[model samples]
Target: MKIKTLIVDDEPHAIEIIETYVGNFPEIELVATCNSAIEAFQILQKDRIDLLFLDIKMPGLLGTELVRTLKNPPKVIFTTAYQDYALEGFDLNAVDYLLKPIPFNRFLKAMEKVFDGYRPINRQIVSVQTDQNKSENFIYLRVDRKTVKINVRDIYWLESLKDYIKVVLADRTLVSKQKISVLAELLPESLFLRIHRSFIVAVDKIDSYHSYAIEILGKELPIGRNYKDACRQRLQN
Candidate 1:
């Protein structure tokens, strides 16, 4: 079943961009675009929406406020120009938070997380068919409006910045709006380990380590207390 989606934003151009991006994914169907929270609330009363693209700074009855009143809110991806609301958005268990002028790649990555959340319930339908077709040496990442190819071996580590992750390579870094947990699943388990809640270090990238931190690429990353035992065992190998 396609995910029923709603785009709630005051800007016509913003709604248009999201409508265009939603078309790229076959699993999502655009239901409606409301210019205000009041209109969106009315639509919600009559429609069953699975995903929501919300703008937090709407004039009255703010997007955040609208979600606060919903007993069972749909998975939300906040698209706005302001960055301050990111922490609050995640506190509401939002699927993703995006900053504007939203890039298509970021939009795609956010949809990926939304799809990942529904994967268990709709496993057969939501699972990426490319997983079966692709080889182990490389992976596809939604980076800047295109699904860019990356060699897994070139990745030094992954740093999580709340709603996004930085893929550190030897020469450059690629940032994508993907959760750390989601990105971790894409990486080969044997070669990667979550040393901290916000960090994933390549097994071969470790230069040295103590009980407190693991050194990678001349930088020391703290080992989360909960992840200490696992990090110790994995890095020692």
Candidate 2:
């Protein structure tokens, strides 16, 4: 099923940019654009939204307080100009946090979260057909309503940005618009390991490992303190 999304911001230009960007992705449906946290509460009362792009600041109510009131909230991607709210935003377990003047590349990465089912790599998707006999370990993703098949074996690493995760593959990277925790759940346990809040690595693709970082495909990924145990165990065994 396509994920339903809402864009909440006080800026018209930022709202327009996000709406246009979301329009390009077939997987995301813009349910409503809320200019204030109060409006978001009203929207929530009516719609069964799957995702939210929320602004940190607003006039009547603060975005942070709005989240606290929700009994069950759709995954949220915080949208704001202020960088100071980053820590508080994550404390509430927001899916992703985006700075203003949003880029298409980054937005596209966020859209990937809607379709990454996080099943086994061998699973068959309606769009990208995989042959079980070929020993090609890959998965097909339903993105923008179009199915694209990706081989897990080709992945160099995974990077997390607030609510988005980028899969660095050999040919091209795929971005899943989701949290690091969600991606960690969906990717295969045997081939992938969470190295940090913003990073994951393909076990076989590691080029080097150091006290502070891991090198993969010439890119270095750091180890988040929250995830160090799993990463260290993976390296040891």
Candidate 3:
């Protein structure tokens, strides 16, 4: 069964990001995108939406206010730039509160909640398909205002630069305006290892390693204290 979904946000770019993420899930059927709470309210009265991706702050009517007005509101995942609205969002029984520039990994976590709570019958099938295909061999990343596809096997290592991540490949490096933690989530766990807060290395690309650091392409990257145990376990097996 398809999960009828609606996205309500004033920002066109924000809506676009959500739309792209939603497209990955075959079970979700996006009903519409609304630019305002008033516009969304109109659609809610007529449609049978199972899930809502709602932006908290709007021009006039707030997303929370619109939810309150509904006699039986659909499962909501609140999206906002401000962190202040988190408490209020939870009070309204939101499935999740997403910050702006939502990471695909974070969005996946929120969607897991929706799937678990709303549809247990299709859980096994969804999980199997999602695990099989989600970022199987390549991933699309925004670089220089365009989406670039990077082969997963081409990656040697990744370096985090605050708000940006440097993707090091066999022949070249591509800098993307995304968190390394977010990019890590997109890669296959069997092929990658997060050795430090600022670094993630391709497991197969490692030339050598010790208790302290990992050697990749003749460069030594320190293993974070918190990640040492997991790193050791992953490399050993």
Best by lDDT: 3
Off by over 4 Å in 2: 117-237
Candidate 2, 32-131: lDDT as tens digits: 8979989999999999988888898888888888999999988888888889999999999887778765544445455555445432233222332224
Q: How many residue pairs clash in each candidate?
A: 0, 10, 0
Query: What's the lDDT of the predicted structure labeled candidate 1?
Result: 0.81
Runs of candidate 1 with Cα error greater than 4 angstroms are 120-237
Model 3, range 54-126, lDDT digits (tens) per residue?
Answer: 9989999999999999999999999999999899999999999999877565677898899897655454322
lDDT of each: 0.81, 0.72, 0.85
Q: If scored against the real structure, what TM-score would every candidate get?
A: 0.52, 0.49, 0.56
Q: Which stretches of candidate 3 lie over 4 Å from their true place?
A: 123-237
Q: How close is candidate 1 to the true structure, as a TM-score?
A: 0.52
RMSD of each: 12.6, 13.0, 10.2
Write the candidate numbers in order of decreasing TM-score: 3, 1, 2
lDDT accuracy of residue 128 in candidate 3: 18
Model 3 scores a C-alpha lDDT of 0.85
